[model samples]
Target chain A: MRIFTAVVAIAAGILILGGYFFPAFEGMQALLLNWAVILAGAAALVGIFNLVSVHTDKIRRQEKGSVYSALLLISLVATFLFAMILRPNHATMKIVLSGIIIPVEASLMGLLTISLLYAAVRLLRRRADLTSIIFLVTAALLILGSATLPFGNMPVLGTFVGPWITQVLALGGARGILIGVALGTLTTGLRVLFGADRPYGGN
Target chain B: MIELTIILVSAALLFGITLWKRKSPANLREIPALTRLHRTLGLSIEDGTRLHISLGTGSLLDARGGSALAGLAMLRHIAERTSVSDKPSVASAGDPTLGLLTQDTLQAGYQAAGVEELYVPTSGRVTGLSPFGYAAGAMNISQNENVSANIIIGHFGPEAALLTEASDRDNVTMIGASDELSGQSVLFASTQDSLIGEELFATGAYLGAGASHVASLTVQDILRWLVILALLGGAAVKLVGMI
Candidate 1:
């Protein structure tokens, strides 16, 4: 089964990738991608069902915070029903998104700042390596210089050092990292294409 | 055309390297993050505590899927190593497609370890749909599941801070890797150990997933140098033309 799956996966990958360089294979590629999209949508449904079952089990088991699980299930059912019946473009559905979902994610985003600060402090306390120290110092300088100071602006740190570090140093490092990431992604994709890595086949 | 040529070249190099190094173990540079992860995996098995792997919200339908694949590679190794433990490893993924694959990967790992009976499908979960929601869900698992270590590897954003913070509060050893630059920055500050940029893809190689992985690393190095040379050569050519 694994070998069968591997052969199918490799052929699909090759055809899809091949379409990019040769237009002759595009029809096959499009067909494969369409199948992928349908499969992905079904996979998402299965994932949601898995989520529902997990919470349901938690409630049945009377585990800790089962009340939360119950609440989640209720919300999930309500949203799913509303989105399905109302076609998702209805104002009621939008409110559920804007009123409930957006605000909740917004609150978490607001909380993220504090979380980042706490983590940074923890990082310094835990590691205290040269790289950590440099990272901390650079961040401190960038944050301090990022905003308009009460004095309108800092003379040195804000204007020169901050801009230099971010634009020159950080950008260069980021580009290097991006190039490395691209290389890695390429190899990984190639491996899958050549059937050397059978992540899908579980070999 | 160029992209195709590069891919073909890389494939050739990988096969060549694999055959050349088939008789001997390839020597690899030490990455402290992976070294620490190796130790943590061992400790979790010995201590009978589970390791939690967060595959993040990387959809397999897009470019972001690369990181999720890396996460799966790491999960495969962790699950196999911890398969015999009283508390087997749990994997949480944010995407449905990824969640399904993760379950299969977990099962395969258990099968490899000769303990497929102990594999639980729920152990590979789709925590949430949205980013923050996923982070919160994953955070809860590490906090409440007696997890000895947290492996956060995939595409992530600032929401990763929440997971790292939760791990920190619980004193669980956490190592993070992300394909996103923002995610990398967040991980650098938040986690004790992080695999920056392409280092995320090297997890499988470090974990001994297969010889192909090691061969791919060598290919990566060779290709990296070629890219550098091309860039420099292009600039030099342009400079001469300008003069």
Candidate 2:
């Protein structure tokens, strides 16, 4: 099994790299990549089946915390059916996505505010470190600078100072995050390409 | 043909270097947590510390393939270890696709271990469509289930803190790794072992569950070196131009 997997992986990588370097073989390579993507898409059904089967059993057994399972199943099945059967146009789909799914997702995201605040408070309880101090201080300033309103009515210190502090940290933090993300992506991509990491099938 | 030849040549060169290596260190397989994953799982089975795995809400496509792959690798490792030990494990997934892959991995691992009946779909539960709901559901499992060790890996967002907080509160020995820094920060604050960036990519290899993941790490290191050189060279050129 291991040998077979290794052989297939080597072949696939060769094909993929071949497609990248050889413009003449682009069509075949592109087709292979497309198939790889399509295969992944097909594999998604495995996930859907797992979701349905698990939730259905929970609903049947009426287990503890099964209500959430039920809700998840209903939402999933409803969305799938709505999309498949209704055949909603792009505009309508957008409305459903934005109005229902987005709001729920966003509100859930908003719930993170409480979690982050809680996490922040927990950090404050810990032994002081430079990283923690920096994190806490930046978080506090960011929160205060943004939430504190009526800057125009306040003194120059309130208006200019708050905005400047927030903007500088926000921009720098954003850049750092971008760099970290890019490096992470590059590393992950290389891993996949080199057959260093195979998540598809297990040992 | 040319590209394939180049790749083969480079791989051969690397293979030769590894074979003919001047001794840098005695140990090549010296990752602490990754080594611990297999060891801990085997030990926990006898001790009865149920494995808790949470796959975050970000879909494979949402987090761009890598997160999904990482999550799957983790699933395979836990599944195999637990199956071998005849221990129970819970896999709670935020995304539907992840839930499915995890389920399959669990079942297959059990089957491989010749305990196919123990492989339950409920083991890989799809908790919620949204983040909070998923977090809440996953936390409920950690609280209610006999889970001894909590392992959270994937594309967790803000709700990651909530889940980690609950895991910490439960006094569960946890290993949390995420591609997102915010999630990583939250996990690092709360959990014992938290992998950041490319380290997350090494989880599979380190666990000895996925050789490809190890190979991937090697490739990642090479890419990093290339990127560093490119950046340094570009900066040097720019400096020269300014001069």
Candidate 3:
């Protein structure tokens, strides 16, 4: 069964990838992608069902944190029902989006700021390596450079060092990583195509 | 035409190296993070602690799915190695298709371990669709589940910091990797062992998934050198033209 799956997958991948160079295979590529999208959509529905079922079972068994499970299900069903009846554009729906969802996400972002700061402060203590020192120093310089004091902007660190570090050093490192990641992505896809590594459960 | 040529060359190189290196052991360089993972894998089986694997929200329908697939590959390797533990490993994914695939991968891993009946569908979860929602859901698992180590590899944004805090607070070992540069930066600072850049994609190879995984790394190195030469060649040619 795994072999059959791998064969089909390899063929599909080859055809789809070949479509870019050979115009004749474009239709098949598009068709396969469409099929994939549809399958993904169906899989999403199944995923939702699985999530609900998992939580539902949790509640049924009176597991630890059963209240949270029940709350999740209730909110999930209620929000879904409300959106269905009142329409997504309705005031209540808008409240759910703007009031609950947006604020919650924003709060998390706020938490991220604090957590990032905390991580940076504790970084030296944790690793204390040369890389850690460089990372912390660069981060500190960047933060300091981005801010303007109550009196006036600094001359060196603010204007010169900041732009040089960001535009040259940071940009160069980021581009290097991007290129490596591109190569990695390419090989990964190729590995799948040649049936070397199958994340699709064939191996 | 150039892209297609590159693809064909990569495919050829991958196939060639894989076949050539089939009998001989792959000489992969030591990555500290991966070494820790290897030790941790053994410890998990010995001490009966579950590993929480969070595959970030990368939809399979798009280009971002590459990291997600890599995560799945590592998940398969981890699941198989740890299936016999008193507590089996659990996986979480943010995207639905990826989540479903993780479930299949987990089951397949257990099957390979000859413990098909021990497979639990709920062990693989679709945590949430949104980024933070997914992080939040998986965060609960890291804290609540009998997880000693958290392996987060895939696509993540700043929300990854949230998981970092969870791991840190719980004193759980976390080895995080992501295709996102920002995610990498966060994980690098927070987690002691973080795979950076292409290293995230190297998880399967590092974990000994198969020869192809190692072959892909070799091909990546060849391509990287080729790309460097191309850039330098282009620059030299342009300089000569100006001269």
The lDDT leader among the candidates is 3
TM-score of candidate 2 relative to the true fold = 0.74
What residue runs in model 3 are displaced by over 4 Å at the alpha carbon? B241-243
Report the lDDT tens digits of candidate 2 across residue range B1-243. Answer: 754553554465444443343333222456555655667677789986688888787675444456666777667767867875545888887766666667777776777677787777678887665677678778878876677777777777667877777766877767777777667777655554566555666676566654344444555556467656867899999989963
State the displacement of the C-alpha of residue B71, model 1, in Å, after optimal TM-score superposition. 1.4
Misplaced by over 4 Å in model 1 are B241-243
The C-alpha interface RMSD of every prediction is: 1.2, 4.5, 1.2
Which residue pairs in candidate 3 have backbone atoms (N, alpha carbon, C) closer than 3 angstroms, thus clashing?
none
Looking at model 2, give its docking quality level: acceptable
Candidate order (DockQ):
3, 1, 2
lDDT of 2 by residue, A55-169 (tens): 6776798877788777777877777788787676757667888898778768767766776667677774643567777867766665565564664334544466567765786
Whichever of 1 and 2 has more TM-score, that candidate is 1
True contacts kept of each: 0.76, 0.36, 0.79
Candidate 1, position A159, lDDT: 88
Candidate 1: docking tier: medium
At residue A143, candidate 2 shows an lDDT of 59
TM-score of each: 0.96, 0.74, 0.97
Rank list by lDDT: 3, 1, 2
